[model samples]
Target: MNTHTRKLIKLNAREGLGVSIILVILFVFLSVSSEYFLTVENITNLLMHSVFVMLVAFGVMFVLSTGGIDLSVGSVLGLCGGVTGWLMMNGTNMWLAILAGLLLGTLIGAFNGMIITRLRISPFLATFAMLYIARGLLLLFTINEPIRNFATPEFAFLAQGYWLGIPMPVWIALAVFLICYFLFNSTSFGRFVVAVGSNQEAAHLSGISTNSIKIRVYALSGLLAASAGILLSSRLTAVQPLMGTSYELDAIAAAVIGGTSMFGGKGSVTGVAIGAIILALISNGLDLLAVNQFYRLIITGLIIIIAVGVERYTSTRAKTA
Candidate 1:
C-alpha cells in the first residue's frame, strides 16, 4: 500500500481497535457462557437480523459525521416499507414500487435538508419534527393496519434467500459495507463532510458549499433508511406503521460505538460495522442467558454513554498529542 493508504489503515485501526477488542471479548465470553451462543444457526441469525439496524447505522453515520443527527430515520424506514408494501398490494410492479418507495425516502431527506439549510433550524429539531410527521403520515396511510401478504418471490429473495450457503441479508450488508467504506475513506465527498463538520464556517469560506453537503448527507441518510425498510418489508410479510419505532437508537449507538464522534468530523465505516456486530452479540447473549429483554435497552443506553465518553477522551488525547 502507499504511505497515505497505510496511514489511513493505521488511523482506522487506531480508532476501531478498542471496539474490535470488545467484540472479541464479548464473543468469547458469550460462547463460553451459553451453549446456544456459538452455534452456526444462532450466529447466522444474529448477523442476519442485525442487517436492518446495520443498514440504518450506515446512513446515520454520515449524518453524525457531518456533525448532525437524524431522528427521523426510524420513521422513514417504517413509512418507506409501508409504502412499498402498499404499492405491491395494489398491484404495482415490485421494482417500480421499490423505486417509488426509495424516491419517497430520498425526497423526505432532501426536504429535511431544505428545512435545515433554508430555515436554519437545528438538525436535532428538524429531524425530530420529521420523525413525528413521517410516522403520522404512515399511520394515516395505513390506517394503523398492517400491510400484509404482499411478498413477491423477487422481493422475498432479498432478505430471505441464500447464496453460497450464506444468508442474503448478510450479503446485502457486506455489499453496503464495502461501498460505504470506500466512500468514507477514499472520496472527496467524505473529505468535504469532515471539513464541514470540523468547521462549517471555514468550509463555507473555503468554497465548500456547506449547505449542499449537509443536504446531500441528509438525503443519503434517508435513502439508506429506506433501504433498511425495503429489506424489512422483504423479510416480513407485513409492514406496520410503527414497525421501525426507536431504531434510531440502534443507529446512533452503532455509529457512536464505532468511534464516530457526535461532535462530528470523524467516521469509520468498519467501526460502524463492528459496532453493529457487537450490538447483535449483546442482544443475542441476553436472549441466550434468559435475561429480561428490557435489560437490553438499558445496556444499549449505557453503551452509548461509554462510547461518547471514550470519544471525548480520545479526541482530547489526539489534540494534546
Candidate 2:
C-alpha cells in the first residue's frame, strides 16, 4: 500500500525469481550430468543430505539479515553434540541431555553476540574467536576423544528414524522452514531485522533496539547449529570435536547462493532453502556419478562466486535505474 512496502515486496519477488532460476538450472545440469540424478531415491537422498546444511543456512539467513555473520556455528554445533553425547553416555536423561546441548549452544551464541555488540567488535572477529574456543571446549569436554551414543537409542532415533518412508531430519527441516517463514514475514522482530540491516544507525536512532536484535539472531543461529549437531550425532552414533569443521563455510555458501546479500538486508529463508538443496544435490549427484571429490569443491566455489556476482550486479542495476 505504501512506498516502503512496495519496495520490500519487489525486492522479495526478485529474490524469489532468482532462486527459481537457480533451481531450474541446477536441475537441468545435474539431470544431464548423470542418469541417476533425477531418480526418486536419489532425490530423497539429496533432500536428506541437504537437511543439515539447510537448517544451518536458515539460521545463518537470520544472522546475515541483521548484517552479521556467525563463523562459530560449525564449531558450536560440534561441541554441543559431543557434550550431549558424553552426558548421555554418563547416564543422563535423554531429553535433559538434548536440552543441555541446546543451552550450551545458546550460551555460546550469547557470548559471541555480547562480545560483538557490547565490546563494539566486528562480528567476523568475535565469531572467529569463538570458533576456536568452541572447538577447544569440545575437545576438553570429551578429553580429545570421540564420544559414543550407543546407549542412547532415543537420541539416535532423532536422526535415524523415519515416518512413512520420510526421514525425520527432512521433517525437522520442513518445520524449521515454516517457522522461519513466519518469523521473517509475520513478526515485528522480522521487520526490525530488515530495518537494522538496511541501516543500523537509522534503526538505532529510531529506538529499534539493534543490540537486542543482534543478540537474538546470534542465539537463533546457535540453536539451529545445535540442532544440526544433534541430528548428525544421532545418525553417526558418535560425536567428534571436529565433526562440524568447515561446515560454517557451506552454510555461508548456501545463504549467499540463495540470493542473500553479503552486504546484508536482503534474502529469503525460502530462497536459502532452495540454495541448500542445490548444493546438496550437486554433491549427491556427483558422488553417484563418481566424480572427483576435489572437483566438487571447485564447482562449489564457482557457484558462490557467480552467485555473489549476480547479487552485486542486480543491486547495482537497481540502484542506477
Candidate 3:
C-alpha cells in the first residue's frame, strides 16, 4: 500500500483508539461505582436497550456526514411503530405491516429531502416541521391509546428473541453497523457524501448530484428510525404514540460523541457504535446509582455539550497543525 493509504489507516486507528479509551474509562468507572454494573444480566439488558439508539445513530451519522440534519427521526419512529402495532392488532400480516411501516418512513424521508434539496428549504426547518407532522399522525392513528395486544410470539421475537445465545437485537445492530461501516468507508457513494459535506458547491461543480445524495441519506435515516421503532415496540410488547419522544437527541448525542463533526465531512461508524455504548452505560449506571431521571437528563445534556466543545477544540487544532 502507498504511504498516503497507510497514513489514512493510522489516523483512523488513532481515532478508534481514542473512542475505545473513553468507553473503557466509562465502563471502569461505572463498574467501580455500582456493584451490579458488571453483572451479565445488566450488560445484556444494556446492549438490548442500546440497539435502537445505535441504529438511529447510524442513520443520523449519514445525514450529518452529508452536512445535513434530520430532526424528524424520533417522530418518524413513533409514527412507524404506532402504525405497525395498530396494523398487527387489527389482524394484518406481521411482515406486511412491518414493510408498510418501513415504506412510510422512507416516504417521509423522501419528502424531507425533496423540500430541502429542490425547494431550497433548510434541513433544520424542514425536518423540524416533519417532526411535528409525524408525531401528530402518530397520535391520530393511535388515538392516544397504546397498542399492546399485538405481541405475537413471532413478533416479540424480533426484539427479545435469542439467536445462538445472543439477543436478536444485538445481531441486528451488528449487521447495521457493518453495513454502514462498509457504505461509509469503502463505497463511492460514501466518497460522494464526504465530498458533498466538505463542500456542496464544489461537489456540484464536479458533477456530483448533491440533491440525490441528500435525499438518499435522509431516506436511509428514516428507514433506520423505523427499524428502531419496530424493535422498541417489540421489546415493550406495545407501541405508544409518544414512544419515541426526545429520542432524536440521544441519536444526535451518539453521533456527536462518536466524533462525527456537526459541521459534517468527518465520521466513523465504529466510533458511533462506541458512542452508543457509552450513552447506554451512562443511563444504566445512573439507574443503578438511584439517580433521578431529571438529573440523568441534565447529565446527558452536559455530556453532549462537553463532547461538542471537545470536537471544536480538536478541529481547531487540526486546522492549525
Candidate 4:
C-alpha cells in the first residue's frame, strides 16, 4: 500500500491503543477500588449511564473532526426535550412530539452552521452564543416549573424499557454508534471532514465545500444532543428548565479523553465509546467510594487538560519527525 494509507492506519492504531490502555487501567483501578464496581448490576447501570454521554460525544467527535466545537449541545438537549414535553402536554401525539424535538435540534444545529458558514463567524463564538439562546428558550417554556404530566407510559419506555433484556437506550446508542462508525470510516463525508480540518483553505481550494461540511457537522451534533435529551427526559418523566446544564462539559471531556484531537482531523467512535465509560466510571467509582460528587467535575477538568497536553505533544513530535 501507499505511504499515506500506511500512515493513516498507523495513526488510527496509535489513537486506539492510547485510549484502550487508559480504559484498561481505569477499569482495573475501579474494579479494585470498589467491590460493587465488579457486580453485574453496577456494571450494567454504569454502561447505561455512559451511553447518553457517548451519544453526545459521537456528535462532538464529528464536529471536532472539522476543527469545530459545539458549545450549544447541552442547551440543545434541554430545549429539545422541553419542546417535546410541552407538545405532549398540549395533546400532541407522542411520536410526533419526539420527531419535533429531533427536528428542532437539527434546525438549531443547522442554524448554528449557517451563522458560522454564511456569516463567517468563528465556530466557538457562534455555538457559544447559541448555548445561551437555546437555554433561554428552554427556561422560557418551563418558567413556572418543569414540564410534567405529559409522559405517557409509552414515552417512559423510550429510556426505561428494555429490548431483549438490554436497556432501550443501549439499543439506541448502539445504532447511533454503528451509523457514526460507517460514516467516519467508509464515506466521502468523513474524508472531507478530515481534509477540511487538516487545512480548510487547502480543502476549499481543492473544490471541497468547506462551508457545507461545517454546517452539516454542527447539525449532526445537534441531533445527537437532542437524542440524549429525549432519552434523559423520558427516564425522568419530566423536563426542568435547566435539565441539561453543563452537560457539554461531559461531552467534550469524553471526546477528548477518547483520543479525538482538540485541534481536529482525528477522532474515533470506538475511542469515544471507551472514553464515555471512563468518564462515567470516575463518577460511579467515587459514588461507590463515598467521595464527594463534585470531585468528578474536578477530575473531568484534569483529564481534559491532560488529554490536550498529550495531543499537543504527539502532534509536535509527528511534525518534527
Candidate 5:
C-alpha cells in the first residue's frame, strides 16, 4: 500500500486499539476481583446485555460519518417498541407489527433528515426536536403505561432465545455490524456520505447528491434504533415508554469511544462494536466490584474524554505527517 493508504489504515487501527486494550485490562481486573466475572454464564450475559447498545452504535456511526448526529434514536426506539407492543396486545399479527415498527422508525428518521437537509437546520437541532416529539408520542400512544407483550411464544425467541448456544440479540447485533461494515466500506452511497462529510461543497461540485445521502443515513439509523427497541421489547415482554431514555447518550458515547470522529468524515462499524463492548465491560466489571453507580458515570465520562483527546492527538499527527 502507498504511504497515504497505510496512514489511513493506521489511523483506523489506532481508534480501535484503545477499546481492545481496555477490554483486556477490564477482563483481567474482573477475573481477579470476582469469581463469577470470568464464568461462562457471566460472559454470555455480558454479551447478551450489550446487544441493544451495540446495535444502536453501529447505525449511529454512519450518521456520525456524515457529520451528523441523531439524538432521536433512543426516543425512536421507545416509540417503535411501544407501537409494536400496542399492536400485538390488540391481537395484531406479530410479523406485521414488527414490520410496522421498523417502518415507523424509518419515517421518523426521514422526517429528521428532511427537516435538516431541506430546511438547512442543523442535524443536532433537528434530531433533538424529534427526540422530544417521539418521546411524547410514545407516552401518549401507550397512555403512560407499559405495553405488555401478548404475542406468541415464538416472538419471544427473537429476543431471549439462543441459536447454536448464542443469544439471538447478540446475533442480531452481529448482523447489524456486518451490514453496516458493508454499507460503509463497499457501497457508493457510503462513499458519498464520507465525501459529503469531508466537504459538502466539494462533494456537490463533484456531482454527488449530498442531501439524498444524508436522508438515507439518518433513515438507516432510525431503522437500526427500531430494531433495538423491538428486540428489547421482546426480551422484556413489554414496551416501556421510558425504556430507552438516555440510551442515545450511551450509544453516542460508544461510537465516540470507539474512535469515530464527532466532527464527521471518519469511523468504522468494527470500532463502534469494540467501543460498545468496552462500555459493557466497564459496567459489568464495576457491578462485579460493587462500585457505586455514580462513580461508574464519572469513570465513563473520564474515559470518553481521554479517548477523544488521544484521537485528536493522533489525528493531528496524521495530518502533519
Candidate 6:
C-alpha cells in the first residue's frame, strides 16, 4: 500500500533468502562431496543432533526478538539435565524429575530477568553472571561427575524412541517449532515483543509492560533450554555437569543465521529451523571429510561472525531506506 511498506517487505525477504541460499548451497556441497550424506541413517542422525540446537535457537530467537540476550541458556541446560539425572539416579520418579528440572530452569530464567529488569543490570551482564552460577551449582550437585541411571526407561524413550519412523526428538522439535511459530506470528504478546524490540520507549508509551515482556522472554528461553537438556540426557541416559559448554554460541549462531536480527524486532521460526539444519549439516559434513574437531570450531565461529555482519549490513540498509 505504501513505498515504505514495500521496501520493508523486500528487505525482510532478502534477509530470509540469504540464509536459505546458504543452506541450500551447503547442503548441495555436502551431498555431492560425501556419498554417505544422503543415506537415511545419516539424515536421521543429522536431524537428531540438530534438534537440541534448534530448541535452544528458538529460545534465543524469542529473546532476540525482544531486543534481549541470555547467555545462560547453555549452562541452564546443563544444570537442568544434571539435576534431572541426579534425581533419577537417586530413585526419583522419571516424570517428577523432569518436572523438577523444567521448574528449576524456568526459575533461573526469572532470576536473570529480575536482575536485568529490576536491578537495572545489562542483559549481557545479568545472564553472564547466571551462566557461572548455574554451572557452579551443577558442579556442586554432581561433584563434577556424570549421572547415569538405568532405571528410567520412560525418560529414555523421550529422546530415543520413534513414532511412525520418525525419532521422538524430531517430533518434540517440531512441536516446539509449531508452538513458537504460532506465538511469534499470531499472538498479541508476539506483537508486543516486536514493538518492544523496535523501540522500547514507543512500546512503553503504548502501554506495553516492557519489563514483564523481557522477563517472560528470558523465562521462555530457559524453559526451552531445559527441555533440550532433558532430551539430551534422555538420549545418552546420562548427564554431565559440563555437557553443554559453548552450546550457547551454537544457538545464537543458528538464530542469527535464521534471520533473527541482533538488533532485534525481526525473526522467523522457519528460518531458524533451516539454520539449525545448516549447522548440523556442517558438522556432519566435516566429520565425514575427516576434518579435525578443532577446525570445526573455527569454522563455526567464522560462520557466526559472517552471519552477524550480514545482519548488521541489512539493518543499516533498512534504516537508510
Best lDDT among the predictions, by candidate number = 1
Q: Please write out the lDDT profile of model 3 over residues 1-321, one tens digit for every residue.
A: 698797766666666555566678878988898899898889988998889999999999999999899899999998998888899999999999999989998999999999999999999999999999999988888775668899899999999899988899999999999999999999999889989999999999999999999999999999999999988989888877789998898899898888887788988899889889888888898899999888998887776676656655654554454
Which regions of candidate 2 are displaced past 4 Å? 2-10, 311-321
Clashes of 6: 0
* Residue 2, candidate 3: C-alpha displacement in angstroms: 3.1
lDDT for position 296 in model 2: 89
* lDDT (C-alpha) at residue 31 in model 3: 89
Q: How far out, in Å, is residue 221 in model 4?
A: 0.9
- lDDT tens digits by residue: candidate 6, 107-156: 99988988989999999999999999999988898775568864476888
Q: Could you tell me which 10 consecutive residues in candidate 5 have the lowest summed lDDT?
A: 310-319
Clashing pairs in 3: none
Show model 4 residue runs off by greater than 4 Å. Answer: 2-8, 307-321
Error of 1 at 271 (Å): 0.9
The 0-to-1 C-alpha lDDT of every candidate, in the order given, reads: 0.89, 0.85, 0.88, 0.87, 0.86, 0.87
**TM match of model 3 to true structure:** 0.94
Model 4 TM-score relative to the real fold: 0.93
- Model 1 segments more than 4 A misplaced: 1-9, 307-321
Model 3, runs deviating above 4 Å: 311-321
Model 2 Cα shift for residue 280 (angstroms): 0.6
Tens-digit lDDT string for candidate 5 (1-321) = 698798888766665666566667778978998998988889989998888998888878889999999999999999998898889998999999999999999999998999999999999999999999999999898885568846569889999889999898888888878888898889998889888888889999999988999999999999999999999889989777798998899999999877788888888788788788878887888888889888998987887787667656765665675
Q: Encode model 4's per-residue lDDT on 235-303: one tens digit a residue.
A: 888888888888888898888878787778878888889889888887788789888777877876776
For TM-score, candidate 2 versus 5, the one ahead is: 5
Candidate 1 residue-pair clash tally: 0
Candidate 5 clash figure, as a count:
0
lDDT of 6 at 161: 92
Give the CA lDDT, 0 to 100, for residue 89 in model 3: 93
Candidate 6 positional error at 208, Å: 0.4
